[model samples]
Every structure is written in C-alpha cells, then in structure tokens.
Target: MRTDRIFGLAVVLGALAYIASAFQLQTSFLSDPVGSRTFPIIVGSVAAVCGLVMVVSPDPEPDWPHGRTWARLGIAVLVLVGYAYALRPWGFVLPTALAAGIISYQINPRPMAAALTGIGLSVGLYLLFKYALGLGLMALPRDFPG
Candidate 1:
C-alpha cells in the first residue's frame, strides 16, 4: 500500500473516531443554537471525505520530507500540544505567540518576520474570536501586565 493511502486510511479511522466521540457530547437547553456537537461532526465529516479522496486518488510520486524537515515537523507538533496545555493557565496571547513564533520561524528561518507573524497572528485571531465571533477568550492572564 502507498504511504498516502495508509495516511488516508488513518485519517478516515481517526475521523470516524472523532465523529463517534462528538456524538457522546451532552448538550443542555442553554447550549448554543448550533449545539456543541455540530462543529466537531462537521469537521470530522469533512476530514473523512478528504481522507476518502486521498485513498481513492493518492499522489503517484509523493515527495516525503527528510532530515531537518522531520525535526521541524515534530517541533511544530510539540508546540501545538504545549499551546493546548498552556491555554487555560497562560490564557490566549502569550502561549499562542510563542507557539506561532516557533512554528513560523521554522517555516521561514527569519527571526524578525517570525516574531511579527507570531504577534500579528496571535492578536488577529484573539480579536476575531473574542470581538467578531463574540467568543469569550481571555486575551491574557488575569494578572498580566502588572
């Protein structure tokens, strides 16, 4: 089996699991109009469809990454995981900026640009989520800037 097909199969299986788990989410009368399970189910469904497409028509000559690229990929995954853990304690901005900075620097290898990208993306996403979407995300920790 081709690597892409294997990856696609994994994605399909993971998406199925995600969808199944989403069904387990308990909602109340006070839940949002879309409900808590809706987004996860939609995301899982989309992922399943994309995975099926990849399984049906994978790249004939997939140029797999090598050497430092693999390291960078691993680092990016670690950063994201750390970001998830740090979100509640550190709030949104600081951890997000660090994670985005590291990942952006890995992609571009430019310190200043990466810093700008990190700060810009962190603030942009914060505003978009908090203000535009009316989501109550903490911009910083309660005692921050003191």
Candidate 2:
C-alpha cells in the first residue's frame, strides 16, 4: 500500500478507461488519416508504460512539501482552475497571461517581471498555435482589444 503503488494503480485504471472510451468515439467524414482516437491511444499507452515503470521501480523517498509550499500549491491550483473556466470566454491569451503571471509572482514575488513574462508567453503561444499549428483559438473579442 505504498504511495507509488497507489499512483500506478490510478494511472493504469484511468488509462484503460480512457482507451476504452476512445474506441467509442465516432470517426469524422473529413478527419486525419489516423482519425481522432490516435491521440488518446498514444496517451493511454504512454501512461500505462509509466505506471508499470513506477510500480516496478518507485521513487525511493519522495520529498513531500510543507508550510508555505502547501499554501502556494493551493493558490496555484485555484489559479489553474480559474484559467480553465475562463479559457473560452476570456480567450487563450488573456487567461494564459494571467495564469502565467500569477504563477511567476507566486514563485518569486515580482509583479512587473511576472506580468511581462505572462504577456510574452501569451503572445508567443497565440502566434504559435494560430500560425504554426493552424489551430483556431479565439483571440480577444473585437470590442475588448480596442
């Protein structure tokens, strides 16, 4: 009943369920060659492999966090959850910037540096996803940017 063993069990079970769900996914008329299930299958396989590896050779003595670290962790989790909820409405760039800046500030306590880092990451990733990947992510709404 070790920590790693529990983690491995969870990983394996989650991956198995995910892969099974992938099989139920309907194929699109104009989808990629491998179809939609490819990513899920690949992800599940990787998770299964990692779970097995962990079960066989778990971390000897994991460093558990304490004190302020727990508070920071809680804040970080809340920030991420907020980011997820706001992603579609606020759009990727703003949420990314906010989350990144908050995390940066949480780590080092520099507001200006955090804001700049957030802006840079948001703008950079927006262009990358839009241009390089040809993904259609929503930018700021027409009225809001101006």
Candidate 3:
C-alpha cells in the first residue's frame, strides 16, 4: 500500500480510539455544558477527517524528507516531549517559549526572529487561553519568584 494510505489508516484508527476513550471519561454533576469528552471528540473527529482526506487524495509522488530534514524532525519531536514534561515544573510560559523558539529557529534559522516569535506566541497563547477561553493555566512555576 502507499505510504500516505498507511499513515492515514493509522491516524484514522488512532483517532477512533481516542474518541472512544474520551467517551469513557466520567464527569461531575457540576460540569459545564461542554463536558471533558467534547474537546477530545472534536479533536478526534478533526484528525479522522484529515486522515480520510489524506487517504482519499494522497499526493501521487510524496517527497520524503532527506537526512538533515529527518534529524530536524526528530529534534522537533524531542522538543515537544520535553515541553510536555517541563510543563508541570516550569509552567506554561517558559517551556512553551523555549520550544517555540527552537522550532522557529529550526524553520527559519534566524535567532532574533525566532526569539521574538517564541515570546509573541507564548504571551499571545497565554492570554488567549487564560482570558478568552477562561482556562486556568500557570504563567510561571509555583516556586518561581516574582
């Protein structure tokens, strides 16, 4: 089978599992209208749709990435994993900024631009999540001094 078909099938299966698991999440009586399962279901649905698109309309000749590109992809994955681990200890802003900066630099190879991009993204996302979405995310670590 084509690589895209295989990847799309895997994504579709994973998304189905994710949606199913989301359905199993228990919610309190006082939970909001949008329950815990809502977001996960939405995400899974989106993923499944995208996977279906890829499966149905894959590129005739996908240009697979070469050596350096593969290495960069690996680094990006590592950065994302590190970001997840650092969230509890470092809080949202710092680790997010660092990860965004690293990925931006990898994409553009411009230090100053990447730094600014990271700062902008972290602050913007923080404000959007905290204020607009009314989500309570830590700006800094609990032990972090003002």
Candidate 4:
C-alpha cells in the first residue's frame, strides 16, 4: 500500500485504458500507413513500462513541489485554457504563436526569442499540416486582412 506502488499501478491502469480506447478509433480507407492507433499504442506502451518500473522500485519519500512550482503549473493550465478558447476566434496561427511565446517566455525570460520561436512554430506546423500531412487547420480567420 505504498504511495509509489499505488501511483505506478494507477499509471499502468490508466495507460491500459488509454490504449483500449485508442483501439476504438475508426480509420478511413485513405489513412496513413501506420494508422491513427500507432502513436497512442506507442505512448501507452511507454507509460505501462514506466509504471511497471515505478511499481517495482517504489519510493518511500517523494519531494513535493513548492509554491513557485505550483504557481507555474497554475499559470500553464490557465494559458492552455486560454489558448483553446482563443483558437476558434483568433485562428490557429495567432493563438498558437501567442501561447507558444508566452509559455516560452515563462520558461526563459527572452521575449524576442520566445516570440520568434512562437511565430516559427506556428508557421512551421501550419505548413507541415497543410502540405505534408494533408490536414486542414485554420491558419487565419475569415474576416482577416481588413
């Protein structure tokens, strides 16, 4: 009934459930060669392995995060929520760039570099999804360029 063992077991169970749910994803005829299930399966497998290890090597004492860590985590959650909310109205490029830049700035206090990184990631991911992956992501809003 150790904490580490319980946590590990929970992780393992959660991973198994995730894998099971991922298997239910229906794929179209023109899906990728690896299919949609591949990534989830890989992620779940890794989680399961880690969980098993944690269960075997359970830690009696764990270091809990302090105030700063908690604050950062809270900020991150807020930023994510804001990003999701903004995505529809502002479109992919603007919201994504802003989120990335803000998060990067939170980690490292370099505003310019963070902004550039955000812009680069936004554009790069947009192009990649649109061209290479054949996925349609909203890059701009309908009433843009006004």
Candidate 5:
C-alpha cells in the first residue's frame, strides 16, 4: 500500500485497460493499415514496462500531503472532466481555454499571467491539432455563423 506500489498498480491497470480497449476496437476496410489500435498497444506495452521497472525499484520516501495538493488535484480532475463534457457543446476554443486556465491557476496564482497563458495554450493547441494534425476541432459554437 505504499505510494510507489500504488503508482505501479495504477500504471499496470492503465496498461491493461488500454490493451483491452484496443482489442475491442472494430476495424473496417477504410481503417488505416496500422489501425487505431497500434498506438494504444504501444502505449500499453510501455506503461507495463514502466510499471514493472517501478515495482522492482526501491521505494522512495513518502512526502506528507500539503494543504493545497488535494485541492489542486481536484481542480485538475475537474478541468479534464469539464473539457471532455464541454468539447462538443462549447467547441474547442472556450473549453480548452478554461481547462488551460484552471491548470495554469494550479501552477501559478497570478490571474493575468494565468489568463494569458491559457489563451496562448488554447490558440497553440488549436493550431497544432486543427492544422498540423488535421483534427478539425471546431473553435466556435456550432450554431454561430461567425
């Protein structure tokens, strides 16, 4: 029940889940030759290897919980869940910006800097995923004529 053991278990479980999900993915004639499952398989393998390494390694000293650590983690989880739920409704830009802002707030308490950083991250990610990766994530509300 040590932190290292817990982390190792988490990694193993994550890997297993990834692998299982990949196995469950259906394929079609239009699917890429490598298929969507390839990356997940690779990731799961890497995670399993890392988990094994962590399990074999000596445990590190555990740090006592800081007052804000749990709060920060909660904020991070909220941001991630919000992003998932808001992606289609709010589109890419606003939800991404909000998520980035929440993450930045945890990293730095300065409001102005966090806001700017979030804007930069949102724009940058939009360009990266939409242009470079050809993801075509909508940047605005669907009904807006813009």
Candidate 6:
C-alpha cells in the first residue's frame, strides 16, 4: 500500500479509537456541561473528516519502506516502553532524557546535536509537567530531598 493510503487508514483508525473512547468514558457529577467525552468526540469527528478527505484525494508517489525504517520504528517503541517502565525507579529526568536522545538520534545523524536535543526536550518537558501543570513527577536522585 502507498504511504498516503497507510496514513489515511491510520487516521481512520485513530478516529475510531477516539469515538470508542468517548462512548466508553464514564460520566461524573463533577463533569462540566461539555463532559469528558466532548473533546474526544470532536477530535474523532475531525480525524474522520480528514481521513475521508485523504482517502478521496489524489494519490501521491509511492515510497516503499526500507528494512532500516522498520528497525528504527521498533527501536523507538522499545525506547518508549523502557521509558515507561523506568520512569518510577529512575525518575522523570534520566529515562525521559534517554528516550528523547534515542528519538533524536533516530531523526538525526549528529551525536552532539542529538544529545543536546534530547536534554533540551527533557528539561522542557520537566518544566511543562512539573512547574506549568503542577504534576508530581518523580525527581532525579540529586533533586530528591530525603
């Protein structure tokens, strides 16, 4: 299948997932008038529309996937899973930084650039989740106050 076709199918699947999530979500008394399902429903509707558009649009040049692409994708997934498992024990910084670094390396060839990008992303995420959102993400060993 062509890349565009695959992308279109992915979009459709995402929309279906969103729609299903919206339906399956439990409502609470504290829920606003829009409800927890509203956003998902809207997102699903938009994704469905975009998928439909893609499906009907003119096909672009087909670019077949190489073996290395699959390997890279597998590595990325593995990194993500490792990060999830490592988050609690290793805390947010190290695992997140490693994951970001791996992703950066996958996208870029330069080692220094990849490392910097990863560190930058990790710090930015820390600031966003910790300070901006006030989330209690596990801190690094050095940052932990016992």
Q: Model 6, 1-146: lDDT tens per residue?
A: 36677788889998998899799999988978888898889889999889877876838757756899889889999999988888888888888888999998988768899899889988999999999999998768655667
lDDT of each: 0.93, 0.89, 0.93, 0.90, 0.87, 0.85
The regions of model 1 sitting more than 4 angstroms off are 1-62
> What is the lDDT, from 0 to 100, of the residue 45 in candidate 4?
92
Weakest 10 consecutive residues of candidate 1 by summed lDDT: 55-64
Which should have the higher TM-score, number 5 or number 6? Answer: 5
Candidate 2 lDDT, 12-81, residue by residue in tens: 8888999999989999799988899999999998998899887887876577798899998899999999
Give Cα distance to truth, residue 50, candidate 6, Å. 21
Return the TM-score for each candidate structure. Answer: 0.57, 0.55, 0.58, 0.56, 0.56, 0.53
> What are the C-alpha RMSDs, in order, of all predicted structures?
8.3, 7.5, 8.6, 8.7, 7.8, 7.1
Could you arrange the candidates by TM-score from highest to lowest? 3, 1, 5, 4, 2, 6
Candidate 3 regions exceeding 4 Å error are 1-62
Q: Looking at model 3, which ten-residue stretch has the lowest summed lDDT?
A: 54-63
Return whichever of 3 and 5 wins on TM-score: 3
Per-residue accuracy of model 1 over 1-146 as CA lDDT, tens digit each: 39879999999999999999999998888977899999999999999999999899998856879999999999999999999899998999999889999999999999999999999999999999998999989988998877
Candidate 5 regions off by >4 Å? 1-61
Weakest 10 consecutive residues of candidate 6 by summed lDDT: 56-65
lDDT digits (tens) for residues 24-115 of candidate 4: 98998999889999999999999999999999998775776889878877888899999989989888999999899888877887989999
lDDT of 5 by residue, 29-98 (tens): 7987799889889989999889877777837858766878988888899889878999998888888888
For residue 118, give model 2's deviation from the true position in Å: 0.3
lDDT score, candidate 4, position 51: 97
Deviation in Å, model 6, residue 85 alpha carbon: 1.0
